[model samples]
Target chain A: MKRRLLLVSNSTLHGGGYLQHCQQQIQDFFGKNVKRILFVPYALHDRDAYTKTARDKFKTLGYEVDSVHETPDPVDAVRKAEGIFIGGGNTFRLLKALYDSKLVTEIRKRVLEDGIPYMGSSAGTNVSTISINTTNDMPIVYPPTFAAIGLVPFNINPHFLDADPNSKHMGETREQRIVQYHEELDTPCVLGLREGSMLLVEGNKATLLGSTKARLFQRGKQTTEHDPGSDLSFLLTEAQ
Target chain B: MKRRLLLVSNSTLHGGGYLQHCQQQIQDFFGKNVKRILFVPYALHDRDAYTKTARDKFKTLGYEVDSVHETPDPVDAVRKAEGIFIGGGNTFRLLKALYDSKLVTEIRKRVLEDGIPYMGSSAGTNVSTISINTTNDMPIVYPPTFAAIGLVPFNINPHFLDADPNSKHMGETREQRIVQYHEELDTPCVLGLREGSMLLVEGNKATLLGSTKARLFQRGKQTTEHDPGSDLSFLLTEAQ
Candidate 1:
């Protein structure tokens, strides 16, 4: 029940530089016991460059990397792992592959049941929950991937915000889309995560991470916004 | 707000072959006001057959036959008509075309806002809700058409139960998916609509249309099932 899970975002990995703030937090959370970081890249391209870059991130943080797909025995790889980090990419692709390979169940057992320290970023975090309902992608891609590792409740609406000003498409705003989801759904929480924000759930307590606010919508009323990093300590201490 | 909005189900036309039980209920719901029947095809090759066949259905019902398309001018077509029934086709394609043409918004205004009785079967019914969050399709096609007219609060997961015994793929059960949706959603209220079931939302009363039951889910609790023909009178009646 004391397993540590760190879900991250991929938007920061773009351009030449990276956001050190989150990476620093990941390192701090894992501490010295974090020897082997399992890098999950089911969300990115099927190419090697993307996977290698994710691997390098952990290497830079002084931990060994094992791409989940490269190994013949994922169970064995996970067994020897100290920390598991799911990198950001297309959540559908990553979740699809994980579901197809039946790796999600293993990861769930390792992290939730067996207390394996785990982490996910972007799509990684999106799939950590029950369903990837809040992903900011075209809804047409149905990746034979429905079931997810129930690491946390609520779908992660990553990179959530008003429509980018530069983009010309007339798609519904993130708020609107989520409102639509809330209109349809009654239980799973929808977390509109800003950049560097996260919901750190340990035991019975769930904490919100990051500097800005996260939006929560329910069935009976309009959405309510909450500032993260505020009184999230309940997440670290609660027992489920 | 009562406007002429026609909803068509592909399963009902052509002598009500696909879903026989729903045909009478659907027709009865529309009563004698249906002015036209536009038979849409699942494939392009079947277009002619549908047009000819649907024209007969329209004639039998003492209505006109009009050619329907994704970009039909609603103001021009439904102006003199009592209703415009859009027969079901591939839900994704029909919806994609509707969305691509930006007709969904106009149609929404006509149907929900203007009070048109828009009815659909299969895909037609599937697309009327907020998003197609509840359709049964392989995740292979990520169409940009998942968006829908904001009619109902909940997404319609049509064809609720897979009656076929020999389906090979093992994903979440429809109930499981909705439950997962509830667990993941911030505010979840999903309706597991069976073939004959519908929510007849008139004024403040959204009565159940068929004899089949609909299921509802909530977070941290067991799922609840509702009987058909029960009074959902408060759903449409209740103010937002």
Candidate 2:
């Protein structure tokens, strides 16, 4: 697999500035070779504002951001882009727009085949998996399907939180929700990416980035937590 | 409009027994004419256990519970049911099961025309609305569509929580997610049913029941909060 993905849990940490926590990793990931990156702002409602945020952020990192919404042909823009970054908002809205613009396949090919670096924050990270079934966002809109880019073999649960037993909230916690998913399907495992954390995959070798620990949920298996710099390369390949 | 719905936020409130807080209202809604109430326990994985929980609780309220999952013919169960109660779990799983069993149209017809007393908690309450778009549940499984039973004129955001201003979590607040839904479509409104609360609809009147307040979100209108006993009948009617 010739895939390079920086799947982030959240764009901004609790008290940190926007993408300030993951600045160095993002800069080093895109590097100098990828001078221009295409930005997908469909996850959010205001594309103009989202694009401006990405433009300013990337500008500081020494890269130019060309928003796909501004282009008449998104597929063509994707084909010619050096790198791609999808800012997060609502997962359903983002996936619906991806299907509406017919950019899923093009973007997948660019990342998996052409090896263009792909960075996803929150909802963007959710859509990069086999399905967006594990996302915490409201449906808001119905996509053509829950099927996503499948850039990775498993589903990604971004901004994942553990259950607080003493809490008054009666609704099932994030862990319980993932358990329900496991009850229905067994094939694609789910990775619960904690806040402030991101997963970086460089071809066959994948590593868990950031200070937070990530929990992996595989059917019929005990949930395992991985620390930062731990090898998650096995996630890049599906279990037969 | 012959819709009779008891759409609740959470089945159990903090420090309360299961369905304990809303016991009297549940009994009153069904009344003496209804004997055996069919239970849709498809929301949870263990149908038998879910059915037992529902059966034991309903028995104390003077009703017999027959689970739809236990019946060989689920469609027939809905057709012959005197009253219906949908136990809550994962909203996506419940909706997917409803679509899989070909019960969406049947359930809608039964409730809309037959006017049989219907009760929903959490996920169940979510599907009773115009769509499951406003639900807080994860899409563990993809339903045929986000279009739900449409038992009411608006969408229901079950177990609605107010944003804790002091919290540091970076995910979109409950209020922001509803705002995003409004930005996309202007038709159906959204009703945020807070925990310990439920909406009681009888014929033409829909009242907010319980000790908590409910929030209403309509496009181009100020967000409104209604206290318990306030008439939300307007939500039962689609704005034209």
Candidate 3:
């Protein structure tokens, strides 16, 4: 079977409910066969509250969500999960939790080998890439390593925004930062997924979803803008 | 002798030459006696170019700058230096280079024990604190640890700016990110130092320098704004 994934830029759009914009795509991605999901809420500080919130959201979609924190054995939980959903918060915290629990490899096996459908938003979308190098979260804690689950070929910068021309802020723009990342580690392309946008991947093929255009960045190359419905499956083959 | 430091928020300000805004303060901090200085250019990718640029800037202030990269023994270079200056680029790269060169403890000893006058800008300023936890730089690489020189009691967020009210960016604002940091690690206070501002430390006493006001954040307490010249010595005492 082919691997299936829905990587969302953000759970909530401005003035919208949590995960409201991506619900239809998420529903279609999981389909009717996968009724139960193993949710990873480690990105959030208040895991219980985050899990409850996610549970309520998934419940409305007629899906039963069981957070990984509730299970005694998280590895076993991943193995038995029909579909996986990881919510957003802090990428460092999420990656650290994944490393601490030793569930990275297990989840990879389940998603890549067993072909269990996987979905993530924000920090979750960040970790779904080659590494969490492009995440915008503050490094509140130090993870053992920067390596992450390579569910996708390239890295994703969730909640991506263009630099405002009117702003006087002297800080490095989002593009400048990503360019610096390329200066150091140039192989993996970076996908800047704007709010309300997502990448739907099935096996080796990936499609850009939603109305907003996504930005693609590569080393020594001009950043190209891809409109919605453009095929981004070529990114998977370009992974080093 | 008391520990002396000039921790600058950034190297260059808007519409100013490199280190131009803080040259007088830097000169005053080092004094006429400290002629030869050891420079750390590890934060930047092109160390030679960064060092030469920094050297040219410091020469205008009547100081001889020698980068640690040029020396055969970096640790020894740290010990014998009259003064130390760390240039800005990436905090993770700077901290990682320090750890890789095994110069963290040596530099710490010189600054904290020997009372060597140390100056740093941007990423360099971030390492002068308890850890590089509050830095605004991207995590391009993983260092051995987040531990830094701890010359100051708290962490620093360089190039700090207020959130724009008119914009509709969905990402967390600078203040929100620091607040999230406090939620995770509440012991150390976070100082949001604007680009034109700096911290002048003498022994346990620290004063906010430059014309702009700096923001101070502590857990369970309301965020406070301090104008330039405000005494921040109290922060040194509150470190855990």
Candidate 2 local lDDT, A1-240, one digit each (tens): 789999999999998888989999999899978899999999999999999998998899899999999999999999999999999999999999999999999999999999999999999999999999899998889899999998998998998888766677777889998988899856588999999899999988889999799999998989999999899989877781
C-alpha positional error of residue B30 in candidate 2 after TM-score superposition, expressed in Å: 0.5
| Clashes by residue pair, model 3 | none
The list of candidate 3 runs beyond 4 A from truth reads: A238-240, B238-240
Residues B51-111 of candidate 2 have per-residue lDDT tens digits of 9998999999999999999999999999999989998998888998999998889999999
- iRMSD per model? 15.1, 0.8, 1.1
**lDDT at residue A54 of model 3 (Cα atoms):** 94
DockQ of each: 0.03, 0.87, 0.69
Model 1 chain B worst lDDT run, 10 consecutive residues: B5-14
Model 3 agreement with the true structure over B1-240: per-residue lDDT tens digits: 479999999898888899999999998999999999999999988899999999999999999999999999999999899999998988888999999999888988999899999998999999888999888888888899998988877888999988878666678889988887887855588899998999999998889999789999988798999999999989888543
Candidates 1 and 2 compared: the better one by lDDT is: 2
Query: In terms of docking quality, how is candidate 2 classified?
Result: high
- Winning model by lDDT: 2
Candidate number of the best DockQ: 2
The lDDT of each candidate is: 0.59, 0.91, 0.90
Model 3 lDDT per residue over A159-203, tens place: 988988876667778888888788785558899999989999999
For each candidate, report what fraction of the true interface contacts it reproduces: 0.00, 0.83, 0.56
Better of 1 and 3 by DockQ: 3
Minimum summed lDDT over a 10-residue window in model 2 chain A is located at: A162-171
